[model samples]
Target: MLDQLRQIADGLGQTLAPFCEVVVHDLLEPDQAILAIHNSLSGRQVGDPATELGMARIADPDFTQVLANYANQFADGRQAKSTSIGIKDASGRYIAALCLNLDLTLFRGLQSAMNQFMRMDTEGPRESLDPAGGADAIRARIDAFAGRHATTPRALRTDERRALLSELRAAGLLDVRRAMETIAAHLGVSRASVYSYAR
Candidate 1:
């Protein structure tokens, strides 16, 4: 059954070739698990030792299958995205492992180009002090404060509300008379309740 699976592994390697390196490991022989390999991106040979994933399967019967993508670097320092899967026998024992390592250098270069192409000017506009916009700014600040405390603005405790008001006052947001009204409306509290928080 394991030998039959080797052809599938080889086919996968060829299909994903150039970028992908695929290897088959025989778990019974930890010292030389590499039974077959394709693409050979890692430069590992048929007689190479089992990887950490194979060793884990050997140590733990429950490690039947492991499919994870992780960062890996080749001996030549080239970065790769690797996925390893452990195959098991009928009795729940891991018998073989298959691994696919994908070179990420080309994708990373494309990502850099995409970022440059999609770049935008972040300093396009400055904020305005219009009453409606000011109210939005005040609500945004309160929401940010609530987020820091892991709660919603309406769910803030009295002490938390007091601290939030203190921060707002220190930021000069409460200097405008309508700012308190805006905060009170946003918090579902009365203007007097908002004022008490300032103390």
Candidate 2:
């Protein structure tokens, strides 16, 4: 089954040539997981060690069918967009892995061109006085505050809540009608509790 999948990897690599690098890994051997490779963009050859993603699958059985796209770089420092998929066996153990890496240098150039074509001129912008916008802004502020403290809005302590309310009040966000109710809902707390924080 793994060998058949390696053939699929080869076909995929050939179909997406030049920009795409396809690799197949056998997870049974972490040190030499690269069973087959195509395009060879990363300069990694067969018999190479498994990547961090493969090791993660070995460590966690639940780490199956993971599909993530993130920034990657080639040996020559060229930017790439990479996507990896983990394949598991019937026993819930990861048996194989396939990764596709796409070089993005040309796409970056195209993005720059598109941006230049859609350039916008600065206009005198008017301030929004919508109550809903104010509520959203307040919620964003609360989330940001909680994130800075390494916690969620609902998980903020009393003192943290008080400080957050104070900051909202200072920013005039709490002056909007029903802003307190919105904040309370976002924090998963009662309206009375939000009032207490305001005090």
Candidate 3:
């Protein structure tokens, strides 16, 4: 199982360009879930005793209330956003978990900036409307977005652009229809002008 996990992790690292790290944790023992299959961590591992217990007892009916979210969601802070999946055995028994931590600070930052814009009474030059924090804030959003979407850093075609936009919307970064309009406006066009691009 450990060997198979390693192969899966390695394949994930290859397939997902922004995937910076992959860690597989064995859930066989409740107390030793913290042990990494391959220990190459630089800082303190992210672990909460309560969270571990919550994951270990997933079969318990009450555990649902304890941890309602077991899927990916945007996290805020220096290290935010991870693609996490709970691994299960053939019999549908929980066995382990796989966490693929990707750099998404820019996407998260852009969402924050958008929120700030929505709150303001007016819209003007982006720089003029920027928060008092200035470039640091802007950089975070841009960095996160670029890192998360432009993994290859290659120029994206219209289809790629639309695909990425769709992903962002699904991730709750943008509204379904409004996001289309926003992208259209960015390209100096209308919503109809972008549909073909998406196709």
Give all TM-scores, in the order shown.
Answer: 0.58, 0.56, 0.37
Rank the models by TM-score, top first: 1, 2, 3
Predicted candidate 2 versus true structure: per-residue lDDT over 57-152, tens digit per residue: 989889748677788889899999888888888888888898999989888999999999998666867666665767878889999999999999
For every model shown, the clashing-pair count is 0, 0, 6
1-199: candidate 1 lDDT, tens digit per residue: 7787799888998899888999899999999999999999888999899988789989998764767788889989999988888887888888888889999988899999999999977889865666555777788999999999999999999999999999998988997659989999889999999989997
- Model 3 regions lying over 4 Å from their true place: 14-19, 34-58, 61-76, 106-199
- TM-score result, candidate 1: 0.58
- Residue 116 accuracy (lDDT) in model 3: 87
Whichever of 1 and 3 has more TM-score, that candidate is: 1
Tens-digit lDDT string for candidate 3 (98-153):
66555555667889999988895457555444333333432343346547665431
Record all residue pairs in model 1 with backbone atoms less than 3 Å apart, i.e. clashing: none
Candidate 2 Cα lDDT to native: 0.90
RMSD of 2: 9.8
